[model samples]
Target: MILRRKENLSKVEQKHEKLKTSNMKWTTILLFLCFMGITMASAQQKTFKGTWLYEQGEKNGTIQLDLYQKSVENEFDMDGALCFGTFAFSDGSYYSIEEVEVEGNKASLQQVLDTEMGNFKMQMTYNSADQSIELSTNGANGLPDKLLLRKSDIQNQETSAESPIINEVDNETSSPINWTSIIGAVILIIAMAGYSLFIINKKNEFDQVYTTEYFSATRRSNGKSPQSSSEEDTQVTGLLDKLQHELTTFQNHTSGASYLVVLKKKQHKKCAGYLRQAIEIASTNPEILHDLQQYAHILANSQKRLFDGSYSVMIAAGIATLLVGYLMSDLLIVILFAGAIAVYYLASFAPQYLILNKVANSSHTSTGFLGTLANIVGNAKVITYIFDTQDTIDTITGDNIYRYDDYSQVQASVFIVILAYLVTGIGIMYIACWRFFRNFIMH
Candidate 1:
């Protein structure tokens, strides 16, 4: 009986030992699994930093995406942290950035930018191995639907090796864009355009307005006494009124057009014929007849001069020359524009001066008042001299009016205003080209 009992005890001890061994094995496995879980969690955290290029049609751009760990928690999950990124067009005109999310070898980012077209929402995914990104978005007009981007580093590396000196210069001189200059240039351009249109409209208004002397002459030419509104004013007055009405009608119809022809030479010739008949009927004395004839001749000439398309051609040529000059790298375009403006401003006086001077010289009275005035006005050199003298007088006398007469003031003022306009236009363009495209120009 004692032997049987001892054997049972030994059997029980073996069973206990077996149970202990099983518990130890389970503990080791659990510890191993826990260690593996912690390692995997640490390994899951990642950071990516690089520049990426994207192209879709004409809309190609660069994006700099950099993801940095914020904390242990964020280290494990990049989406919980901040990722800095910037997107810029090829021209470097507009740029924007926003926080992004990263996981494994891919990162998903979302950003919104306010542009001239409208608001744009950008969604992108990046692959670290290829240094590429896929930009995807829903159908948004003016915004890319899908874009593929490769790293710019490779391209930049090739460029840097080829043009180290140019790159160095760019780095030293070309900093970030000058926002002030850009804004100023745009504002100046708008202001210049508005002012130029205003000037042109003012000139048109002047051309349409008849002087008091002209109305008096018209009334005198007609045989009938000047009557109230109901009575027919005069043939000249009626024709002018008709012309004015037609102009208003044309203006109303083609308000945005550059030029409108309301009265043709045929209409003006009819007016002249009516005026001549009226003058013949009203001719009572030799002096009155002579005055009436002179008035008729002036009316005919004025009608012929009303719509001088030469000025338009000159202006168009000047502007075209300026644009072509800029493209061709010639300063002659600037000179051409300046000269054209000068000619346009002095156009009214020039033809009169030339004709009057020629008549006076032929009549052998070239030294008389009319001859002297014509010579002074017609000769470009004499005009330049007068302008210079007036400028000198202005500088020396300050506020006190001295050598400059009404005629001189008119001429000088016109020239100076045109010059100022040209200078201002050039200055605006210079600021735009220099500030915005400095790198392109310098390199």
Candidate 2:
């Protein structure tokens, strides 16, 4: 009987140990599952992306926030795309959108939104408890309109729907064959070539006409005008005529077939300089001066027209190259080449635009300065001296300001170009590596 009791006690002890082990295993698994659940819940609690409408006093506006999912480690998805930022939630409110100032837990949003009545600012307050939002307007006073919005309301409704028609439409529209763009590119190339050729031929024709009309003219018929007295006058007129002929030839030669349009710019500048000199030399003679000014005006106008045309053509070409690159993505080399070309053109144009803007600002400042000086300076000698001194000082100061602004703009442009190059170069290199790896594995 003692041996049997001891055996029963041992058996009970073994059973209890087995039960304890099983309980521990289950407890560990349960804890692991709970941890996983908490992580998933945290991820899901992130902010949703959509249009947030808000109101200010007597005005309504809509703030559209496009959120991207975070792609890199240490980054969280703001909307669908990953971004390197953490979500901020405080005082019963959450802030997730970009470009809005958030203080504590409150966000201030001002935007112009289209409404049925026209455009208005729609002010909204978000409450996390009931997933409810309230909208009010300063226009509508303190009486706020309440809206109950669930998480589903901000979801991408289209993504949930299974509609073949919609999918087909999107596929067709988003990246269609772009035959129109192709045709336009071809037409543009042809038109540019034709225009350049026409300009060359027209300039040649004008030169011939001008030479024959001016050089072959019989000395002013006896009674009509006084004879040119100074030998210098005759010599100057002859030089002017020769210079014009040379300019016409230069324009025709340089502008006709060059891929680099800047050559044409240099020619235009030369023409302007010659015209200015001719006007200065012939200033005293009415008829001669009139003719010279008219000729100068013609040259100026032609230069402007050509400059504008060239700018348009270059822009079109850049766009065409980008489009072709996009369409012919299979040819990676060609795509890269096109991208480089587009970037080059962009860089060139950016500088030219900056120069033009600078010139315009300078002109405006000069005009304002002159106007102010004229208003302040009377006929008095002392006033005149003061005006001249001040004007000179202002000119120097204005030039310094312009130089600083230009330098800043140039620095900004350089930074932007560097950033673009880095991004594009990395992307291209990654694609190349990926392709190489894929090909090697396939083989």
Candidate 3:
């Protein structure tokens, strides 16, 4: 009897193990199905790519969906395609759709106004059967729930036919960006930049060395008076005589500087140049040497004002161009600025550095043609500079201010200019760039 009872107990234990194994197998199958369901739902191809219009109890507007823009986001992360949208109500109220979360056919749309997440939530369900979307909203007064929006009839018929071109257009789907073109363009730009630099270096090679040796601060520190040679004295005196002749001959058409301003600057650079040569090789009187040095210093300081002003203008244009380019995301727009600004700016450097650097000024050899024409496209600063008559600071000391007195003034100007241009030139592009960067940095 004991042997029989032990055998029976072992059999029962084996039966219980089999039952547990069967349950485990079924649980595994169920979990696999659930996972697959979620995957399929999320991975399903979806596009709400047409203008959707709804008229439900006087809540009517068009929701334009750009098929080209795909926004994917994971909260507080910055790694998803931007979801682009706009909401225009019949009451002339327009709101931008800033956030989108989609799971299968359902999507939640969100927006923020004045730094606050709006109190309204719009949920949409895409109905494939009707090519329509059912929208539900909560937390907003007088908003309709279960609002149905049909695709525009043309879009509907096109969708029904399912032509690839029509579908792409109707959905506003854009192809992937061709990075190859952009890379090639950038490489070309770099090569051009290098070539420009090389050309400038080759053209002005000796001029640089000559100017630097004479005007360098080290020359100031040396303080060793250059003793005269008879030849140098004769040469410098001849130059001085010619300069005096030019200044005094005020009436004849002898072909010197045209404008009064040009006359003054040419006179200044010539005077400065003459004094420098004279001091290097003229009489050895210390008092005479000191006075020449002082006057030379004054002329040098004054002549530089024109170059300084032009340089300042160039710098401001550069900053504005960069800021505008950096803030814009559209490849076409960025390219436009890069090309125009590059041509406008780079076109001038050859003239400025190699040609007119010895006497850089606005009304002189450096300022008229190459850059100003190209830069006239969009730069406001360039516009002002082209028309600007003031070329010097008079003096940089004793209560003189350059540009604006405070940085806040600069900030305001930048902000205003950016706003104006964005509004006038790039309403849609601005929205697209803003959305792309917003998700990228703050997702």
Candidate 4:
């Protein structure tokens, strides 16, 4: 009996040891999994950095160049044209080009560069093995354009034969720095400016026509008034008497509508800032909260209108600047103007349009005298709310908003049309510069 008890205890000890071993194995596996997940996330965070060649169309023609981050969250340079801020890969599906601009899974390296063209939208694919970036546009007939750069071409120099070398041995070594290329670039700039100017002129014409047509159509819909004042006055007096009677009837029967209109007029009067503070205080004491709400709404709306109009004007100025830049081939000028135009329109024009639409469509919900007063006062509130609800307040406040202006939009359209002419001008300038530099200056 003693031997059997000892044997049973030994078996129990063995079972506990076995369980402990199993637990350890599982713990090891869980740790390994955690490590792998962390490593993967870190690797993904690595920026794609290097100098890249931007080739479009034939290789012999003008080509753009760019410098990108070796990994994620770094700065990049665009062929002496533009330098972008830091970028990052937020998830496996998308990345941010700069801290602000985000792109989805369909986003690739080449698409980023194509944004500079300001004309065509493109996509990109990266090749890790060859260290190359390829681009393609969307839609039918989309052919991939391959741009290759070896890791050695852009990576940090190592103290080994495989590392990229920058030789300063030949101080005078130069590649004739193509005068034709410089000339071409200059001409292109000029042409763009000229085209922009043309667009502005065209936009003015279109706006004039549109405004005239709108007013004419409206006037025609309303019958003309009689020329004789004496005859008209007699008819008008009778109509006025009838109107007075009807208004009295409306005040009694349709108090809601009449109250609403009166409330609206009062709100407008308050917006004009003619209301005495003492009167406002008395009204407030009487618990005329509806009147106060209406006043506030009107004031807010008026402020918005003022801001929108000012912004529209600013956008117009920016468009004008863009036109000037296109004509002058001054990149700095163009960028400044374009930027201003974008900011004004985004801030004022776009929000106003949205607000106007909302106000026109939205229905009043408030009832009774106070409700009707609130409804009347809240007309502007509805519009302002719509503006606030937009997905991009910055975009609404940014330079892109100026693009919505009739004049600006028209000008931009015209600029595009006149771009061909500008291009021609640039070509001529290029040829002249090429001849002067190659034939005369070189000799």
> What lDDT does candidate 1 reach at residue 106?
53
Give TM-scores for every candidate, taking all chains together and pairing residue i with residue i: 0.24, 0.23, 0.24, 0.21
Worst 10 residues of 2 by lDDT: 163-172
Give the residue spans of candidate 2 off by over 4 A.
Answer: 1-180, 183-186, 189-329, 332-443
| Clashing residue pairs, backbone N/CA/C < 3 A, model 1 | none
Q: Is candidate 2 or candidate 3 better by lDDT?
A: 3
Residue 369, candidate 4: Cα error in Å is 76
Q: Candidate 2's residue-wise lDDT over 133-181, tens digit each? A: 4534445222235432333334332222322111222111211222233
Q: How far is candidate 1 from the true structure (C-alpha RMSD, Å)?
A: 38.2
Model 4 lDDT at residue 33: 40
**Higher-lDDT candidate among 3 and 4?**
3
Name the runs in model 3 displaced over 4 angstroms: 1-63, 70-175, 178-181, 203-347, 352-443
Per-residue lDDT over 196-283 for candidate 1, one digit per residue giving the tens place of the 0 to 100 score: 2332332211223233444444444443343223333244355444443433112222356432232333444455555545432332
TM-score of 4: 0.21
Question: What are the per-residue Cα lDDT tens digits for candidate 4 across 275-344?
Answer: 2231112221122323434433433343232122233234345445545555555564455345434323
Q: RMSD of candidate 3 to the true fold?
A: 30.2
